[model samples]
Target: GADVVHAHGLHAAARTALALSGRSVPLVMTWHTRRYAEGARRQILHLLERRAVRAAAVVLAPSSDLVDRARLRGARDARLAPAAAPSPRSSQAPHEGKVRAELGAVERPLLVAVGSLVPHHGFGTLLDAARVWRALDPVPLVVVAGEGRDRSALQQRIRDEELPVRLVGSRDDAGELIAAADLAVLPSRWEGRSLLAQEALRLGVPLVATEVGGVPELVGEAAELVPFGNGEALARAVVRLLGDPERCAWLAEAGREQAAGWPTEDDTIAHVLSVYDELAQPSPHPR
Candidate 1:
């Protein structure tokens, strides 16, 4: 008999609660992100989310926004447990030049955006912004590294508009790609402690991200933040940061400083283990 069951994501927690129907085992849920479903699917998810939050003995969230969300969904106890991004692989540093040349960003500025090619990820907004960069000398090359159902449509727009953007599909060397760029863009409509943001800052690469969800809390003043879904603001921020070499340098250093304040992998493990220990204890008055 398990003493505790830990489930991650809304769906997993809901299903786990259903599976544990008549059991006494305590359940711990971790809310990662909200499902971007719509209409009937959205309503169904809302019901499931409520059930999951209410059923969990404790809900762990990676960001403050998510903690609030869980509480709103009826979680009795929710705690902030920031997820740590894995440190960049040291070997990737040596191949930076090679990556830039391969991506055809050797002479021009390289902007890297890593996320699924989906609507909520806001890659479309990024492409719209890239259109503005066409007039610049040595136009920046925007390379998105991920794959999803929205790939075909995004690719079509890139070609139709003659945008300097390329869908590189999914790559295992995302860290390498990010490290090799002049700037890293995170145009997502929402995020909870974005791994790309963490990696970019850690590598001393300047970043421009949307001010949504936990991003502001995560990056603070370390990176340039613009309103979500605003292509002009996004483009302006990127251009301004690129032109101001001094600020970009300052931001790079500030990014590392900010990243230093985030929870480390060991810290995350210790915190989670403590939660497990607390939950495993027998109640003073057994039910």
Candidate 2:
């Protein structure tokens, strides 16, 4: 155990570090996710994170965006680490028809976009694109989970657009829904790297998402990228996935392969411990 300790995110890894630090153990700090692009409120948050960041033995970042933000907030030396991706806790095999049935989606083709209803998550863009898809062939069902202050407005947008969508806000069973989906998407304007996308890829759902932040870093060949806020392009990709069953199946399988090879929950624990180890290690050149 390190003389000082720190951790990031809400997972057990962060909690463990906090618990150890409570015994007067020195724990460093890490910030894995932040609100969004900088503005007045963001600057205020940056100020707060900056204050917290300076006390850490070493700051850790799970995505380049977060790394950059931490650096911007004065965490210049925060170590960079890929976000630890945990596989589905139980059986989550995706059957063609059965999985769709569970989600109340018909057996045509399903394109799921998972994220908060917030502006940063791009749920509104997703709904707008889905409206375009309504006129396209083999229309998809967009199943979104997560809740925020924008939930009501997003709901109104859904009603206004008349999109084929299901808004399952703030759920624990989101993984099962991801498994049931044909594709998983994140339409966020900015992101630190979406945990939702990681989980979806782990379940091997085909990914149609935007190119931003660490998303491109993790999704690699598994996703079709579009510019952020280009509803037309995003809509086209969804339609493409929906129209082609063979391709959808292939993408789904490919996504699973990529996500399965990613770090496990235990791996997250190991990485976090390694950070603590570095903080505890003897410095070659010390004051």
Candidate 3:
């Protein structure tokens, strides 16, 4: 007999399992994020979310905000266990000079962002901030590396505005680029413990990210947090960090320290096992 069912998201497969089994076994559902494109699809997912939350034996959330959302949906047991990261490849520091050279021949302050070129990822806001930053004495080069359906539209905007932003399509060495950046910016509208945030902090890259979803939880004062969707705020934060070298160094050092304390893959596995153990215990009988 199966001991438990673990559902990652409110996808069709998870919905099917919930429908077919009706909570026959202990069910653990991890709510990464509730973000979805608005429409009939979003409505359907919200309904599924309610059903899944009610049926789950325990809901694991990466941040407390999501735990609250789960409880609102009628989840009886919701726990916070921030996502784990793979072990670092080596303790050696990243070579900033080499990585910077790889970015481009242009010698300008490099700001790197990596994510799908989608509306929710909020590349539009970043582009606007780039436009605003162009007046700086030494203009920065905003390099974005990713691919999505919004590629064509974003490209057109870049051309129309004549912004100092480059959409370099997709990149494999995104981590290297991030390590080389004068600043790592994530102006996402919504997020749930992003891997990019983790990578930036781990590499000791000074970060300026939007305060949305679990981003604050990940950065935890180690990086500058800006309000989401405000291009002016994003631009100001980036400009301030670039001008203050000492502040940037402090943020980078603090980021590395924060990243050091993150849970490892083994720790995540152990937490999952403990949850299973709790579920497997037999209940006491009443007389």
Instruction: Please tell me which predicted candidate would have the highest lDDT against the true structure.
Output: 1
- Model 3, position 187, has a per-residue lDDT of 92
Which 10-residue window of candidate 1 scores lowest in summed lDDT?
86-95
Backbone clashes for every candidate come to 0, 9, 0
Q: Residue by residue across 149-226, what tens digits does model 2's lDDT show?
A: 888898887888787877877877677777677678889987665777787776667788889878887877887788
RMSD of 1: 1.2
Residues 52-165, candidate 1, lDDT per residue (tens digit)? 999999999877888998899889999998688786575626578899999999899999999988899999899889989998888999999999999999999998999999
Residue 122 of model 2, lDDT score: 83
Query: What is residue 185's positional error in candidate 2, in angstroms?
Result: 1.9
- On TM-score, the leading prediction is 1
Q: Against the hidden true structure, what lDDT does model 2 obtain?
A: 0.72
* lDDT of residue 5 for candidate 1: 95
How does each model score on TM-score? 0.97, 0.82, 0.92
RMSD of each: 1.2, 4.1, 2.2
Model 3 Cα lDDT, one tens digit per residue, 72-117: 8788899997579645555554587876676662477999999999
Model 3: worst 10 consecutive residues (lDDT sum):
85-94
In model 2, the clashing pairs are 3-26, 4-26, 4-27, 5-26, 5-27, 5-28, 6-27, 6-28, 204-256
